[model samples]
Target: MSSDRQPIPPTRPTGHQIIAPGHTFATVSDKISSIVLTRRTPLYWFIPFLIASALLMVFLVAVTALLVRGVGLWGIKVPVMWAWAITNFVWWIGIGHAGTLISAILLLLRQSWRNSINRFAEAMTLFAVACAGMFPLLHLGRPWLFYWLFPYPNTMNVQPQFRSPLVWDVFAVSTYATVSALFWYVGLIPDLATLRDRARNRGARIIYGILAMGWRGAASHWQKYETASLLLAGLATPLVLSVHTVVSFDFTIAILPGWHSTIFPPYFVAGAIYSGFAMVLVLAIPLRAMYGLQDLITMRHLDNMAKVMLATGEIVAYSYIFEAFISWYSGDKYEMFAMWNRMTGPYAVTYWTLIFCNLVFPQILWVKKIRTNVVWLFIVSVDVLVGMWLERYVIIVVSLHRDFLPSSWGIFHPTIWDVATYVGTLGLFFFLFFLFIRGLPMISIFEVRTLLPQAEVAEVEQ
Candidate 1:
């Protein structure tokens, strides 16, 4: 190769040379505050908030009726005791897992792309978990005694059964929720401080300042914050795995033929991520458009997320196939019958819907053109979420409807309360998410700014 044609050596910056004037870290703090805080909240913010609030009121009314009247108002009966309540519980919990996976797991993996979305995803996780935690408690007809699920000294001298998967669910979900909140709040400290400084009024400043916990941009503070975050991430990874594993156990450990399975742990985890990411995309697309964050939450971010959705979609497909193979290989007549029932029996419509939504629609993402198209990505994400919900319904309802005893075989249906609450939960999730976006930064300003290429080069030169 000619000398001029040879690869040019990378230029090295000299020490203490000013690349640009007034480039202090404080400037970054100010820029972020300006982007997030507004003089008055936008009208678009009120739409989700109002709708969510209205739905939440309806949920309260329905729940009160359930408490006053009893579980009889629900569609639950013999051989179908577990209906929409448990389905909603599991589905919401699964959706909750996505936020932690994006925020904690990807952070440890050093996936730089996570910087743009992790904060909001973390918030989504917290709110989803909050919405999810309600179902298990309320599913107990007497919500008053729901606390008995926890281990504490009781007059009956009975301890919560450690052997029961439901108890395990109690512990796992509680731990996951608590740890996720701490992690999300800890990450927000620096950004909150930025807000504290930028607040136009004394009340807002005081509120943000207190929440900031006296955070300063000192090197020592960042070091400790990062170390704490890393430790929390380590703690959170296994917690995430165990939480969903326990959820799977709730079904798998049952003696019902269709419920028993060895493949549930990984399968459930993959499904959780798949649905969680779908919710993230659904929320992100709207927020990006609403907040004028198109540049920060860019097409590149959507493309990367679509790739993840497609990969997990395939994993779920594999789980579906493996379930079929195992059911056939076991040669248990009841198991085979249960599988057959799902495909061609009473609820075949729901079964086909699951396949079409979860397995087929996601395949579109395999096309590079489809993955990058914002409208297509949004549509596919919504489709995947619906499919995942149906998948959970299929697993729970189908298995329970036709357990070992042929005499117990029956079809289950949901009542108006069931549909109302499901819609209400969606409202709750979006309501919390809307508040988070309008009141706090939807994108992680600190993390995104750090991802700028110039900042990376500057850090290296230093």
Candidate 2:
């Protein structure tokens, strides 16, 4: 008997069939343009411009002081050479990781929620990297001859040692910054086109139009854009992972008891993500409120990000425990002493503060109530960032203060220039972010449109 079944034919598009209308995409484009271009009042432009200008001036003054006076102005001295500057460098670099992880990794994973925050997150990565890069240059006593770090044949007889972690860090950070900027700019083209069309003035229209490269929302262009984005995401994922690992190598490869450890790479990666997610939350909450993007950046986005923070926080906590266990297991007196010193030594306050902020506070996010509340999340995020900074401080200061030579051991302190430079970097990071928000679309309009329920259903039906 013939089976009562029909063969399923391949679904094919008909040339005459009407293409689905993209109202949701158009609406998101309008909303994004409104945020970037339309200021309700002069304060929209004035506040950011004023704040950024002030911060930039401070940064310039601080740098000039650093250049004129020299590294002697900072607190760095014998035995405790690495101080706030290096700590800030590592912290900022770690902060940069979150943006790439959110934008590139989550994009490749097809996590739709990433659309709400990826643009600003990517911007944060670029700015953070820029800030991070400044420290190493300034940390060098002779800032003018900093090119010695690079391998130039014939010009300098000494080539950069491939085995050195600092050398690896230079390559890794430069590559990450370059690739992240390219990925961010490539992703911005469509949104820039949206801005081009929405511009009210000739100057605005001309600038945005040029940046948009005459993009007309053509299907072919979208196809190529999507492909390029995926390839970049693929490249960035490994780059993100490797960059942090290389950074860890700077400490781990050293013979210092606390610094040399196999577990550092993962631990550092987790801490980076933990702090990075906290930063994203800190920035996102204020931005969503300020830009009237509550609907676009929904509670769902916060909840999802909270989960990421919680997961990474747990990893960091475990890393702390693992470091303890490894110290004990290795039966190395110096390692054990270093671990003990971190807990009950002179800088125990910093160490415990790290434990409380990075590990303890983040546990509160496990509760749905706390995670969903934007205010609480923002508070926790700040706490986490503080804790992360302290963690770095503990790692650098505590370990180095009482190293192999008991006679040479001493406490490290930040001088006026150190304080100014640290504070100035924050100003610079914010200055860049503020300018980015005012001048460019901070959210991905095209990606957000794809997240609308109606759009999802439409795609499913198709």
Candidate 3:
């Protein structure tokens, strides 16, 4: 008997569509711009913003205390001179990587999915770098003289010690922040123009119009905008690798046993991407749910992000194993002891937990169910973040606590001040993020509009 049903035509995979169907350019713009332009703000928005503000206050208090009492307020000790401050610094820097990777490298590759998420990811980078920049300054005993880190022609003629990795960080992080800010703002121009046109109040239009810098959507304007974006993306792509690699240099160039290995550059880069993606998810999941942006963000973005976490997590896992193997294989007693100490030392619980968080927990992502499940993905993202923090703690504190001389071995415990400073940075990050989402379109209005079918049609016509 002949089947009544004709063979079903092979269908394209809908699993990774960047934007949901049935949306047009008008809807995309209205939905996104309205979030910023709405007369009445949502109750949910205020709750997190208030919490972040409170935390930002705590950060200010913590910084004030540090500046007043000096670095003595922190838990930094003799051998563990680098404690929470350095750990937080490195962690925040690493966290900034995903934004650059998603915004720049992926943009270069012409990955259309990035259009939905790149705006806030770039914001996250700027915010995280801001938080990271604060640590090194505070870590300097005389934070008042922070300008000394910069090279300038001055009366005193004090030059930053060029040999110090600390000096390199100043240049690296500053350049990263500058380029990232430009890239973020350039991307915002078109969106700002949209907001300017869409705003009802004259004041709102004036503000956005000023930021838009008189964007009229002319053909020449589009041509110039595309060129600037490409140039910035090209500049920023290397920063994704360079920033973290330079960060790794802070450890590798040192004679410290755990930090001396050549594997650190790639290892840190992989770990940065791993944690950065986790953070992106951590932010994306709640925001999407809160704003009812499911159609715009879609599970496809979440799934792709999770897959990235998995691939980077594998690399991180390999780095951990290689780190230990090299320590043992080097035949240096210091290296062997460092590895042994990490496994069986006072901070052994932290090490094992890091392993579970960075390696074991993320493995579940290989299963598609976990990758697609928002709640599970969020939890795993959090786990990876914590694991990455613990990894830094293990690398810095654990390694330093037990040095070559037994007499130098001393435990590092974070004082309340240390905890406050760290928690305060967390506050600062969220606070900036809260303000960003409220004031600007968290999703790019113009970029997301480009993902619509109409854009493709318009492009073909052009």
Candidate 4:
């Protein structure tokens, strides 16, 4: 290893400095690229990969059984038609929100701290979206006919109902996926070129060379890369808010008691961001430790992420209060009953657990010590993820189980298959993420290099 590429001493960053002192352009590039290039595949990497792969098999088996035995294998009965699947769908979608917010919005704001973590965060977004997308298709009964949801010309002349928010999700998610993939790939071109040039193996160089598209680090290439990145960032900025808002419409447009509320849009978006940041911390904390990248992903990054979680958690808490208030103030007996049932009914445990998880536990982040502690941050992040999932469960299952007419009311229980399927998706997510870490630069090499003192001087001189 080159002397310049040596790891920085493990030291906690003081104040809000993004990167530690003593890093140069070469150090930044070499340090990040080495993870994907020259480093030996550590034993720890395979341990989780094997576990995730085992879970992935569970997902495949569950999916195959669903296809063979039908959606009846799930707990979806008459009144409780939407259960674990929809809850998992919404939760996964919400988890994806932080990536776009961190990568696009922060980039536009010129926040340099995002450079270290945005690559993996963006990958998380794509992977989460991929996981979320699977449920709607499986929920369609005929999983093979999912393309019918699209407004394509066909012989049957079947068109998706334009008024239905489910149909709206078809377009919204597809658009979000396309734009996110483009943005992610566009960002990777420079890094791909870096890998291509540095790889010792012939096959690795060829594969990366194809992905790099002949990027030569020219002045003109940099200008075009900057312009394209800015334009994509501009386009993606609105998607951070719009996609989840459209998702909320799936419930809001309904006349069902808990479902029909104006506040759902903003409420859902805030919750999405809240859960999304928690996931970033969950992924970041372990990754930094395992790779000995404390200097690169400093305490400053963890602090900022915790602060974001705190802010969004507060918004979600207020939304909960306001939701209850509106139900009482409007004197809507059905809405009131929905809220009452969530508190006192059979599923009340989930509701209260979510309350403590999303609202109560996260309040500890207000303390600077907790925000900077990696172990506490990981615990809080896991708590938030659970809280967010239960939040969806309360919103979907609890609300649907007991309608105004008692005759039609029914309890929704998640069968073994439902648990299997949900757990399977978790496996799928981690499996893809593990593959990503091994194959690509998890941090943006060129972007982080720009944060070096010499690069700043070069920019000024130019």
What's the alpha carbon RMSD for model 1? 6.1
Backbone clashes in each candidate structure, one number apiece? 0, 0, 0, 0
| lDDT value, residue 284 of candidate 2 | 92
After superposing candidate 2 on the true structure, give the runs of residues whose Cα lies further than 4 Å from its correct spot: 1-23, 41-49, 454-462
Candidate order by TM-score, decreasing, is: 4, 3, 1, 2
| lDDT of each candidate versus the true structure | 0.83, 0.85, 0.90, 0.91
Most lDDT-accurate candidate: 4
Instruction: Give per-residue CA lDDT, model 1, range 364-459, as digits (tens).
Output: 898999987889999999999899989989999998998888897888889998888788888888888887876786666677556544454433
- Give the alpha carbon lDDT tens digit for every residue of 1-462 in model 4: 235853321111122357788888788888888998999999889999999999999999999999999999999998999899999999999999999998899888777788889999999999999999989888889999888888888899778899899898989999999999999999999999999999999999999999999999998777677878888888998987999999999999988899999999999999999999999999999999998889889998999999999999999999999998999897989999999999999999999999999989899999999999999999999999999999999999999999889999998878999999999999999999999999999988887776665553222454
lDDT tens digits, residue span 1-462, model 2? 124743211111111111223446667778788877776534655686677678777778889988888888888988789889889998999998999999988877767668879999999999999999999988887788877888787654778889888989989998999999999999899888888989998899999999999999898777677778888999999999999899889999999989999999989998998889989999899888877787777787889899999999999999998998999999989999999999999999999889899888789998999999988999999999999999889888889999877898898888877887888888899889988988899988877666654543233454
Report how far off residue 203 is in candidate 2 (Å).
0.8
Per-residue CA lDDT of candidate 3, range 1-462, in tens?
Answer: 135844321111213367899988899999999999974689998999899899899999999999889998887889899989989999998999999999988877777788889999999999999999999889989988888889999999677889988788888999999999999999998899999999999999999999999988998777677767878888898877988888988998999888898999999999999999999999999999999999998998999999999999999999999999999889999999999999999999999999999989899999999999999999999999999999999999998999889988898889999999999999999999999998999998877777766664222454
Return model 4's CA RMSD, one decimal.
Answer: 5.4
Q: Point out the worst 10-residue segment of candidate 3 by lDDT.
A: 7-16
Reference-based lDDT, residue 63, model 1: 83
Q: What's the C-alpha lDDT at position 143 in model 4?
A: 99
RMSD of 2: 5.7
Write down the TM-score for model 1.
0.92
The TM-scores, one per candidate, come to 0.92, 0.92, 0.95, 0.95
